[model samples]
Target: MYRAIRIHGYGGPEVLQLETLPTPVPGRGEILIRQEAIGVNYIDIYFRTGLYKVPALPAILGMEGAGIVLAVGADVTDFEPGDRVAYPTSLGGYGECRTIAADRIVPLPPDIPFDVAAGGMQRGLTARMLLREVYAVRPGETILVHAAAGGVGLLMCQWARHLGVRTIGVVSSEEKGELARRNGASDILIGYDNLAARVRKLTDGAMVPVVYDSVGKDTFVASLDCLAPRGLMVSYGNSSGEVAGISVRMLATRGSLYLTRPGLTTYIAQRGALLGGARDVFDLIAQGVLRVHIGQRFALADAGAAQTALETRATTGSTILLP
Candidate 1:
């Protein structure tokens, strides 16, 4: 038997329960993984609090993990026993052992450690999708980022800098601002008050072509105001709360702004896309172009605490759970 964290109903962190279950056997097209590290992310909190629905009750609650494959089911030819692999977005990750679709897992590079792999995969791919695909940021362009010291925020700042873009990062405190600056944020704003005015000052009143906003509700309007005409507002997360009660006319009034709530899954829905995106993320990490900070580690049984830390903005960089 192996241990897993499961939630029977939606609520706070206390709803997370650790229980023992029989080890799963791989089904057709699946592989049984001995999960070494589990990633803690805000999305997990979303599912936990009923903001996002799980397929059923008593579901294991984690989106990403790194592990060694111990068994491959029938017709699974690409992976075998003892292969080191990781997945960026899959349910049932908050367990000591679990079976996942084989195609969802990627081989870990020799240079990338398991902890780093688990920590960086989702956030790194998210940064890639936001920077390269969604807005396709150009060099010399200034962009605004919310929660800039957070996981995806930090990665986005660094990756954008690597591509010659300037980031105007909005952080909650001076300490977080300093962290964002160290990770390539060209400018930092502490707190959300007068956010657009502050951004306008930083960008010489030209505003930015895109605003990457993960803090929803509280900063949505200010983020929209920080954009240039016809700019894209990539509202990818909701750390503050879900964005709501906006009409289509809001976009028109906001200088014809384009808004998108893109997730990593849609950006990498295909097998080729998944492998390609993961490869890019791993390559950048391996080459030291993107530095992943494993800021906090928790025992698998303490996943509730990990999620609470992430949800409360109490942790920085990446938080992982060790099994």
Candidate 2:
């Protein structure tokens, strides 16, 4: 038997319950991982609250983890028993043991710890795609990041700095602003009231070339105004709410700006894609060019509290769950 967190009916964090289930065995092209650490993300809240739909009830809702491989299914040769690996599994990550496709698992480097590995995959890969893939953020280029003290923000800020890029981070408070500045932001602004104007003033009347927006709905229209002519708006998440009622004509009106909703799945759809994206993230962490800060830790049983912290925007950096 193995322990896992599951929800039969989705509503709130209170719905997360710990239950024992029969241990799963790896089938063809699969592996069973004994989880060491789990990455807690805002999307987990969406899944719990039914904002994101799952095919069935009684779901195990988590997206990423790091663990030791206990068994590998037939035809798997790159990994063996006791191998340490980290994966960005699309589901079933909020458990003591998770079964994943063999190709989805990446062997962990010696210098990367379990807690760091789990935290790095989701957020670090996000930073990778944002800087290296989305618009190919270049040295000396300026970009804006929402929730600039959150997990992805911190990682992106550091990597952006390493690339000699300038970052304009938007935060909710002075404290978060300081955190953003410390993470390599050239400037930080409070995420309220005339946000685009603030960015314009900070950039000397020239807004950022790209704006990395995750707080959707509440900031979508404003984010459009924060971009420079022909800028890219990378809307990857919706912690505040989902972006709604998008009008394609607005793109033409808004200086021919480019908008996209990028996700890890699309960015890493195949092994080659995964390898390309994961290598950038893992190498940065391995070389100290990027830092993954785990700001909150919850026991497997306290998953509810972790979700509450994230949904309320009450935590910074990354949140992790220990099994």
Among these predicted structures, which one has the highest lDDT? 1
**Model 2: how far is 72 from its true place, Å?**
1.4
Cα lDDT of model 2 by residue, 1-323, tens digit: 99999999989888999999999999999999999999999888888999998679989999999999999999999999999999875688989998999888788887889999888798998888888888798888888989989999999889889999999888999998898898898888886689988988888988888989889988988999988888888899998888888999888898999998888788898899887777778888888898898989999999999999998888999999999
Model 1, C-alpha of 5: deviation from truth (Å): 0.3
TM-score of candidate 2 on Cα atoms, chains taken together: 0.97
Error of 2 at 177 (Å): 1.3
Which lDDT values do the candidates have, in the order given? Answer: 0.92, 0.89
Residues 265-316, candidate 1: write the lDDT tens digits: 9989999999999999999998888999888999998898898888778888
lDDT agreement of model 1 with the native: 0.92
Give every collision pair in model 2.
none
**TM-score of each predicted structure versus truth:** 0.99, 0.97
RMSD of 2: 1.1
